[model samples]
Target: MPAQADPEPVTLLLVLEDTETLSSLSDIGEQEGLRVLHAESAQDALAILELEPVDMVLCDALTPGLDGHEVLELIQERWPDCIRLLMTDVSSGLEEALRAIDEGHVYGFIPKPWHEERLRLLLRRSREHLGTQREWMQREMALLEQNQDLIALNAALEQRIEATQQELKQTAEMLDKTYDELLHMHVTTARVIGDLLHHRLPRHLQTNEQVYALVTAFCETHALDHTLQQDLQLAAALYNIGKLTWDDHLLATPSEQLSANERTAYQHYPVSGENHLMAMPQLKRAAKFVRHHRERWNGNGFPDRLEGSDIPYGSRLLGLAVDFIELQRGMVLPREVPRPQALALLRKFAGRIYDPELCHDFVKLCVEKAPDLQTSGKAVISLETSQVKPGMILAQDIYSASGMLLLHEGKRLDQHLMDKLKNFEEIEGRNYTVLVYRP
Candidate 1:
C-alpha cells in the first residue's frame, strides 16, 4: 500500500516594508509548520488575502500606502474571522500598537526583533483557534438540516390526520342515510302486511285503529320519541297477528272468557308476533315491544312477566291501549262497555295490570284530548281528488269507488300520501270523494 502524504500546514500572510525582517520571520514560520506568503506592502497583502485562504495576517505598522491599523481594519471588515496581528518596530511606537488593539483591528502585537520561539507559539495558537471555529460551523449546519427535516415530517403528518378526519365524516353520513332508507322500507312492509291482515279480519282492524289512536295520544303526552311512536303504531296494528294461526272456536271466544288451553294459547301470541317481526332488523325494537306488551305491572302478566320499569316503555303503553280498546269492544266482558266504564276499569287495574303513571296519563288524554281528535267539532269538508291537499286530516275513511279502503279516518296527510292518492286516482280512473279536516 502507498503511504498517505502529510496535509498542508496553515498559511500565514506577512506584510512588511523591511526585507530582512520578512526573511527572518519566513524561516521561523516554516520551522513552526506554517506556510509563509511574503507581501512587501499592505496593498500586496490585501491582494493576496482576496485571492487565497490565509489563517492569519502579520503586518508592520509603518508599511507604505497603508498602515497596520488600515490594513487590519480592512481585513476585519472583509474577512472578519481571519486572525490579524501587528508587528511594531521602535519607529512605530507602543502608541500605534495600543490604538490598533483599542480599535478592535488586531488580535495582539508582536514587537520587532521578535523571538523565534514566541512567534512560533503565537502561530500555533492561531491555527488551533481557526480549527475550533470550523468545527462550530459544521455543527451549526447539521442542526439546521435536522430542523428542516422535523418541519417537513410535521407537515406530512398533519395532512394524513386531516385526510382521516374527512373520511370518518363521510362514513358517518353514509351510515345515517342507509339507516333512514332501511327504516322507511320496514315501515312500508309492516303497513302492507297490516293492510292485508285488516282486509281478512275487519273487526280486528277496527280495534287496531282505536288502539293505535290511544297509543299516539299517550306517546304525545309523555313527549316520547317520534320513531318510537311509529314503532308502537306498527306493533299495535299487528298485535293479534298470531290469532291467524288459531281455530275458529279459539278466535271466536272472548279473551276474558277463554278456557285454560285457549288462554295459554292466547298468551303465546305475543311471542309469535315477536317471531314474525324479528326477521327484520329495522323492526327489532318493535318486536321487543310486541313480545312484552302483555306483561303486567306487578310481574303477574305473562311470557317474560317483567315488572315495572324492566318492561320496555313501548310495551307498557301498548298494554294500556289494548285493554282500553278491548273493554270498549265488549271483548273483555260479556256486554259492550261504555267509554266511561272502560276508563273506570283502566283506573281500577292501573297498578296491577298497567303502569300506574301511564294509565293515569291515558285516562286524562281520553277524557280531555280525545274529544279534540274527534271530527264532531273540527271543520270536516268533502273534497274531490283535485281539491285534496297536504296537512289535512282524513275525517272519514277514504275508499275507492269499488269500496276498497284507501286510507283510514283521522290519519294525517303529507305530500307522499297525497301523491299516492292522486296517483291511484289518475291510474285507476276511479274518482275519490275524500272527507278531510280543513287545515
Candidate 2:
C-alpha cells in the first residue's frame, strides 16, 4: 500500500496597521500550521489576493487607505469565498463595525488590542467553516455530474434494459437514490407533465390524483411487487398524457358530448401516451400500462381491444382507477355524480366493461379507507385551509381557482401537504372549503 500525502496548509493574509498585533498573529499562524502572509496596507492585501489563493483575511480597522470593514467589503466583492475578520477600535468605529457584521461584509469584529484566547478560537472556527463550504461545493458539482449521467441513462434506457436484468435493477436503484432528479430534469418528470395536464385539462386536476390514489391502494392491498407498484404509480400519473396532442376543443369536450370522429380521436390518447414514453426503458412497463388503460374486459375497448385477463395486471388496475375517478368528474357522462354514486356506476360496468373481481376488491378498499363513503354515519366538518390539521380525512376534494382538484376526497393531511396548501394559497390567492371527516 502507498503512504498517504499531507493536507495543504491553510493560507491567510494579514492587512494589519498595528505592528504588535501583526507579530502576535504571525506567531499564532505558525502554531496553527498556517501559511501566513502579511500586508502593510489594504492596497497591498488586494494585490496579494489577486496573485495568491487565500483561505482567510484579517484586516486592521484603522488601516492607511481603507478601514477594516471597507477592506473586508472590497474583499467580499472580489473574492467572496474567503473568511474575513476585521480589527477595529471599540470606541471610535464601533457603529461601522456593527453595520459590517449586519451587512455580512465582515465575518466578525476583533477589538483593537485583542485577547489571544478569543483570536485563537475564531481562527479555529473559521478553518472548520471553510472546510464545510468546500465540502458543500464538491457535493454540488457531483450532483450536477450525476444529473447529466442520469439524462444520458434515461435516453438509452431501452437498450440498457435489454442487456441484463441485473443491470436493469442497478439502473432502477440509481433512479431511486436521485428519484427526484431522474429525467425531465430537477423534479419528477411525470409530476411536471401532470402539472402541464392540469393547465391544459381542468378535469385532470379533478381526476388525476384520485386515479393515483385508487391505483396505489389497490396495488398495496394486493401486495404487488415493489417495482411493479412504482411502475403503476408512474402509469397512474401519466395514463392520459396522450391527451396533450388533442386540440383545445377536443380536450374541453366531455366524452358524452364528443361526436363520432371526436370519440375516435379521444380513444387514441392511451396509445399516444404509450408511444411518447416508449423510447425510455425504465418507463417501458409504465408505458405499457398507460397504453392499455383504455382496454375493456369484453373486447369493446379501443386501440387493440385487449379483453379479460389478457391485459397486463397493472393496466387492468390502472383502467379501473381511471374510470372510477372519471365517472365522478362527469367526464364520461353529462352530469357530475357524488362519490357513492360513482362507486355504484363503476360496479354496474364491472362484468362487461371491467374485470369483475378487481372492481369488487377496489370498492372494498375505497369504503374501508374513505370513511365518508360509508353509510355508517361519520360526522363531517367543513374547515378553512388554515384550520385543517394532519390525520384528518378529507371529506371532499379541494379545487384550484381553475377548477383543478388540488387535494382529493379521502386524502389525509400531513404537515408537508399543509405546507403545500399554504404555499398554494399564497401564490394563487384562493381559499377553499376543506371538508374533513371527524376522527
Best-fitting candidate, scored by TM-score: 1
lDDT of 1: 0.79
Model 2 Cα displacement at 119 (Å)? 99
lDDT of 1 by residue, 32-53 (tens): 7788899998889989998999
Off by over 4 Å in 1: 1-132, 207-238, 247-254, 257-260, 277-285, 321-350, 357-438
Q: What is the lDDT of residue 81 in candidate 1?
A: 87
Report how far off residue 310 is in candidate 1 (Å): 2.7
Check candidate 1 and list the clashing pairs.
Answer: none
Name the 10 consecutive residues with the lowest summed lDDT in model 1. 368-377
User: Model 2, stretches more than 4 Å misplaced?
Assistant: 1-187, 203-205, 371-438
Per-candidate RMSD vs. true structure? Answer: 10.9, 27.2
Estimate, for each residue in 38-63, the C-alpha lDDT of model 2 and write its tens digit: 99898899999999899999888888
